[model samples]
Target: MAGSIATAGVVCAVGIAAAALVGIGAAAAESQRAAGIADAAALAAADTLAGFAAGDPCSRAGEIAAAQAGSVTACDIDGLIATVTIETRFGAIPVTAIARAGPPL
Candidate 1:
């Protein structure tokens, strides 16, 4: 009976560890997704800001981020450079990432 209890305890611990690892992996994936979205949005905005694309730069950033299942939290344009911050979610947690795009200085 004691051995059976110890086996059950070990199983429980292992299960908990597996769940934690899965959660961590999911968070990492969400982070990466947010980063990609921010980068893409920033690039799109920069293109607009640089006159390579039409429409407002920040609006373009919002559209790009929205298409990727993210929201643009902020966008700023400095000359030909564009900066974008985006937010995405993993479960109940919010993941945010920022990126800047422009020609070489």
Candidate 2:
């Protein structure tokens, strides 16, 4: 009976560990998704700033981020450079990332 109880406890612990790992993986994916959105938004905004596109730069970035299932938390343009911060939520947790795009300088 004691050996059976120990086996059950081990199984429970393993299950819990597996669940934790899955949650971690999910969070990492969300983080990566946010980063990608931020990159795309920044690039789109930079294109606008460079006169290759039309519209407000930050507004363009926010729109792009929204289309990608993210929200733009912040956007800043300095000369030809565009920087964007974006957030994507997984459950109640918010994952965010920042990216910048512009000419090399």
Candidate 3:
């Protein structure tokens, strides 16, 4: 009986470790998605900053982020460059990503 209990405990521990790994993998995937959204938003906003698009740069970034099911937390434009931060959620976990877009020097 005692040996059986020990075996059950080991199995429980392994199960918990597997669950943790799965959670970590999910968080990583969410992080990647957030990054992609931020990159696209930054590029869109940079176009506005460069006078290739109309409307405010930050507003354009927010629109792009919204289309990707994310929210733009911040946006900054310097000259023709644009930097954007975006936020996304996976379950109760919140993931944030920042990206900058600019013309090649």
Candidate 4:
């Protein structure tokens, strides 16, 4: 009976470890998705800004960023700067990306 109990404990520990691994995998996937979204949004915003004059470039960039980000949080843009915040199921995880274009030297 003691041996049986020890075996059961080992199984339970293994099961718990498996569950934790799965959870970690899911979190990693979510993080990757968020990062991809941020990157795309920043690039899109930068492209939009390139065509615009020099007035409210950030707001214009933000609009483009929002469109590309889809369900993610709205993009924040200030002048040539762009930022994005994303939250996952576990908690609020903020992802940020910036885009800048300088004069040709």
List, residue by residue over 4-96, the lDDT tens digit for candidate 2: 999999999999999999999988888888889999999999999999999999999999999999999999989999999998899998888
The parts of candidate 2 lying over 4 Å away from their true place are none
Candidate lDDT (C-alpha), each: 0.94, 0.94, 0.94, 0.57
Error at 87, model 4, angstroms: 3.9
lDDT of 1: 0.94
lDDT of 4 by residue, 48-95 (tens): 556544445445545554564534355565664555543334355544
Q: List, residue by residue over 1-105, the lDDT tens digit for candidate 3.
A: 999999999999999999999998988899999999999999999988888999999999999999999999999888899999999999877889999998988
Q: Please give each candidate's TM-score.
A: 0.95, 0.95, 0.87, 0.61
In candidate 3, what residue range of length 10 has the lowest lDDT sum? 87-96
Looking at candidate 2, the ten consecutive residues that score lowest on lDDT are 26-35
Steric clashes per prediction: 0, 0, 0, 0
| RMSD (Å) of each candidate, 1 decimal | 0.9, 0.9, 1.6, 4.6
Global local distance difference test of model 2: 0.94
Worst 10 residues of 1 by lDDT: 74-83
lDDT of 1 by residue, 23-99 (tens): 99988988998999999999999899888999999999999999999999999888998999999988888899999
Give the higher-TM-score candidate: 2 or 4. 2
* TM-score of candidate 4 versus the correct structure, residues matched by position: 0.61
Model 1: residues >4 Å from true position, as ranges? none
Superposition error at 98 for model 2 (Å): 0.8
Worst 10 residues of 4 by lDDT: 96-105
TM-score head-to-head 2 vs 3, winner: 2
